[model samples]
Target: MNELLTKLSECIEFGKINMASPYPPNMKGQEGADEITRKALEEGVNPQDILSLGLMPGMERIGVKFRENKVFVPQVLMSAKAMSTAMLHLKPHFLSGAAKQKGTFIIGTVLGDLHDIGKNLVGMMVEGNGYKVIDLGTDVNSEKFIDAAKENPDAVIGLSALLTTTMVNMEKIARDIKEAVPGTLVTIGGAPVNNDFCARIGADHYSPDPQGVVEFLNTKFA
Candidate 1:
């Protein structure tokens, strides 16, 4: 059983989607995350254990690799794809209350920014780490963010911006969220964002990488 779980983890870490997927070359023709995860469930392995011991470990390794620049966006996106495929099997368990998520996370690319690659990566990473991610997509505004936050009062908010011009909008959104929903945690990121900007904008946190966002949520909720 443990071996099966380990295989599942390897599938995610190496971006193996299924036996049919061949992108990773060496992992080709092997049962991948999609297959292994379903097999684990068939054998009666607890869903939560599959998530914690299998999926999370794989995602953590990939996250660290991404942060260290050992892997690039293409690799990370492949891993996210594998993870998301496996998650389809687990979603029912979550809905049935057999598994619980860490918390809700609302993420978006701030207004004036049409970039989505960075925002999508963060959403995938957060979701892989057990948070229920609600992606607002690109070109998001202050009102949309505040509305989502109000709907999910306990949720954390993440803002992404790839351009210096659009990054400034994070301040407005962050401030508005805080004003409309005091004590809400707002995290800002993207190429033009940093801890200094985060402070200046009155946002709660800033992280250059997706793993940092995961760690922040874990620490905040733990």
Candidate 2:
């Protein structure tokens, strides 16, 4: 069972989606995350174990590589794709309450900022680490974020902005979310934002990369 879980982790780490996927040349034809996860479930592997052991570790590895510039967006996206393939099998268990999620995360690109690559990467990374991600997409407004926070009271909000012009929107959205739903945590990120901006805006956390976001969430909900 442990061996099976390790193999599943490798499949994610290398971006092996399925038996027929040809992204990584050396891993061709081997059982990928899609097949392995389904098989693990059939063979009585616990769904939660698959998430904590198989999926999270693989995502962590890729995220670190990305932070160090050892891997680029394509590799990270492929790893996320592989992890998502495995997630489809586990999602039913999650819905049935047989498996547990760490917490809920509501994410969006701040208003007037139509960028989604950073937002999407963070959402995928957060979801891969076992949080339920509610992606509000680009050009999201303060009211939309506040509403989502109200619906999921315990959820953490992540605001992303790639433009300096739109960063002011993030500050307002974070303040609005907190005022509308007291005690909700807000984490901010993007090219123009930093820890100082986070502190200035009264947001809870600031991470430079997806791994930093994942690590922050883990610390909060652990």
Candidate 3:
């Protein structure tokens, strides 16, 4: 059983979606995340184990690789794809509370920023790490962020802005959420933002990559 779980983890790490997927050519035709996950569940492997042991480890490894520049966007995206594909078998368990999530994460691109690739990647990484991610999509503003924060008071908020001009809105959004929910945590990231900007905005954390966000969440919620 442990061996099966390990194989499932490998599938996610290598971007194998299924038996038919040809990605990561080295693993061509091997049973991928989609199949391994199902096999684990059918054999009565705990869904939570599938998440914690199988999925999270794979995600953490790929995330660290991404931060180190050992892997690029295409590789990370394929890994994310594999993770989501496996999640299909586990989603029902999560929804039914048979499996647990670490916490809630509210993510979006700040106002006037139409870019979603960064936001989506962060969402996928955070979600794969066991947090329930609520993506508010692009063009997000303070009002929308505040509302979501109120609705999920315990959730950590994440803001993304690819354009320098739009990065200013992160400050306002962070400030607004903190005011609306005095103890809420805010994390900011993007091409034009950094720890210096995060400090200036009073956001709780800033990460250059998805792995950094996952590590921050683990520390805060551990």
For candidate 3, the 10 contiguous residues with the lowest summed lDDT are 8-17
Per-residue lDDT of candidate 2, residues 75-129 (tens digit): 9899999999999999899989999999999999999999999999999989988
Question: What TM-score does prediction 2 earn?
Answer: 0.98
Clashing residue pair totals per candidate (backbone < 3 A): 0, 0, 0
lDDT of 1 by residue, 7-112 (tens): 9888888899989999799987889999999999999999998898889888889999999999999998889999999999999999998888889999999999
Q: Tens digit of lDDT per residue, candidate 3, span 5-35?
A: 8998888777888999999899997999999
Instruction: Report residue 84 deviation for candidate 2 (angstroms).
Output: 0.8
Backbone collision tally, model 2? 0
Q: Which residue pairs show collisions in model 1?
A: none
List candidate 2 stretches off by more than 4 Å: none
Candidate 1 weakest ten by summed lDDT:
165-174
RMSD of every prediction: 1.0, 0.8, 1.0
